[model samples]
Target: MLYNLYNEKKDNRKEKFWFRAIFYLFLLIFIGTVCWIFFFSSLLKINSVEVIFQETQTEYDLFNKDYLISLVKTAFQTESSGFYLDHISRANFFLFNVDHFSQLIEKKSLWISKVEIYKKFPQSIQIIIIPRDGAFILQGEEDFLVDGQGMVFAKKNDFLKESATLPILSFEMKRSVKINDQVLESKSAKFLTIISSIFSEQSGFELKPEFFTPSLISNELEAQVVIDNGWKIFFNTERDPVIQSKLVRKVLDEVIKEKISDLEYIDLRLPGKVIYKLKGQPINADDSDAQESKSESKEKKDDRN
Candidate 1:
C-alpha cells in the first residue's frame, strides 16, 4: 500500500508539471496575439499623414506635400516587412528615410531637420524639415545656399528672379562650390590664413572682397580684390598676404595723406616695392619708347629755334 501511494504521488507531480507548462504556453500565445493586434498591426496601418517645415516657403511646401509623402509611403512599405517596437530602431529608420528622401528631392537649398512617423490607423507618415539659415549666390550664375559648415546645401532655380546679396567666390570652376568640405581639403586653408592675418592687423575695418580673380603677371595667383568702397587692391596669392597687406596700408596712408586717388594700378607682388602708376601713365615697356620720342622732338624744336 505504501509503494502504491509513492507511485501515485510521483504521477500526480508529473501531471502538475505538464498542467503548469500548458497554462504558461497558452498565456504567452494570448499575450503575443494581443500585442500583434493592438500595437504592431495598428501601428503598421497608417491612417493619416502630417508634414512640417521650419519655413513656409513655396519650395518647402512643394517638397513636404508632394515629393516627401510619396517617398515615405514607399519606404514604409519596404520597412513594414521587418518592423519592431524598439524606439531606437524606429528613430534610426526615420532618419535614414529623411536623408534618402532629401537626396531624391535634389533641391540643394532645402535642408531636412526631422522626419517623424505617427500611428493614426490605415497608412501614413509625418515629415519635418529645417532649412539652412544663410542663402548665398554662386559665381553670379548659379544660386547656391550654404549651411553653417559652409556647405552648399541647395541650388535655387535660375528663373526664380531673386537677387542674392552674398559675397561671390571667384576661384577656378571646381566640381563643388561648397566652402566647407572642398575648400578645407584643397587650397582654402592657406587663403583663409592670409585673410585672417589681414584682419588682425586692420582692426575695425571690414575687408570683404567682392570677387577674387587670378592675376596674370605674377607667379603667385594675384587676386583682384574689389572692396565695397569702389577701390580695387591687387593681392598676390604666393607671398605672405599679411606682409603685403601692411605694405599696402602704408602706401595707402601716404597716398591718402598726399590726397591722391587718381592711381591706375598698385603692384603688391614684389617685396619692399609698392609701384603705382598714375591714372594716365603707361605701365608697360611701350612707355619708355614714347618718352624717348617726346625728348627727341623737344631737342629738334630747340635746335630749330
Candidate 2:
C-alpha cells in the first residue's frame, strides 16, 4: 500500500508540470505576436504611394506628388497610440489607418476641397485630390483667395507669386472675416460661375470678367458685375441664374448690333423684363407711355389743322 501511494503522488506531480508548460507556451506565443505587430511587422506599412489629381497636366504643378507623399510619411511616423493591437508605431502593416492619414493631409493643405485615399493591400496607397477653383479674390483689409464654393482659403501673404486672372470681389460686410469664412456669398459665386459658362458658350463674345460689388435691395442681397469697357450688369439675388445669364447675353447682342453708346447700367431685377437707363436719360415704362400719348395728340391736332 505504501508503494502504491508513492506512485500515485508521482503521477499527480507530472500532470501539473505538463499543464503549466503548455499554458506558458501559449502565453509566450501571444506576447511575441503582439510585439511583432506593434513594433516590427511590415504588413500594414506603406511601401509605395501614388498621387492622382483630377486636373490636367498643367494643373498638376499646383499640387506636388512628392510633397504629398512626404507629408503622409511624416504622419505615419508620428503616430503615438491607437485602439487595436495593430497600432502603427513603426510602419506596421496592420497598424496604419488610412482615414486618419488622409485627415492629416487635409489639415496641412487648406486649398484642397476633397481627398480620397485607397489602400491596395500589403503595401501600396493611392491618393486622389480635388482642389478648389480659384474663382475670385476678396480684397479688404487684406486679400483672400475665394473659390467657386465661396470658401476663403488662404490670405494674400504672398503664397501665390503670380496673380490669378479671376475677378476681384468687393464684399460689403458689416464685420470682418477670417480665413475659411464665406466672405463672398454663395449666390454671388454661383451667379459668376453661370455667367462665365454662358460667356464661354457664346462664340463671338469676348467678355472679360472684372470686379463685383454686393448690395442689398428690399432686404434681399444682389450683386453687380463690372465687365470690360465700363459695362455694369446687375443680377437678382433670388432669380434663376441660368435665365438671367441668357437675358444678359441677348441684351448684349442687341446692344452690339445697334452700336448703342453712352450706356449707363443694365438692370435685370424684374422677371421677363429688362430695365436700362441711358447716361443722361432716366426714361422708364411710364415716361415712354406718356411721351407716346403726347406725340399722338400732336399728330391729331396737325391733321385737324
- Compared with the true structure, all predictions reach lDDT values of 0.47, 0.59
Residue-by-residue lDDT tens digits, candidate 1, 165-241: 34444445444444233222123334432453364475223455344544211234333433433344555554455
What would the per-residue lDDT of candidate 2 be over residues 1-305, giving only the tens digit for each residue?
99999999999999999999999999999999977764566655567767676642243233344554465555555652343445434444555667776787678767666778787877777778766666666778787877776778877553433533555556465357678887556766666555654644642243455544543112132344333455555666455555556555666566433543555566666544566656677733212223333554576689799
Q: Model 1 Cα displacement at 282 (Å)?
A: 6.3
Model 1 spans with C-alpha error above 4 angstroms: 3-11, 30-137, 140-165, 170-185, 188-209, 214-229, 254-256, 281-305
lDDT agreement of model 2 with the native = 0.59
Provide the lowest-lDDT 10-residue window in model 2. 215-224
The best candidate by TM-score is 2
Worst 10 residues of 1 by lDDT: 284-293
Q: What's the residue-level lDDT of 262 in candidate 2?
A: 56
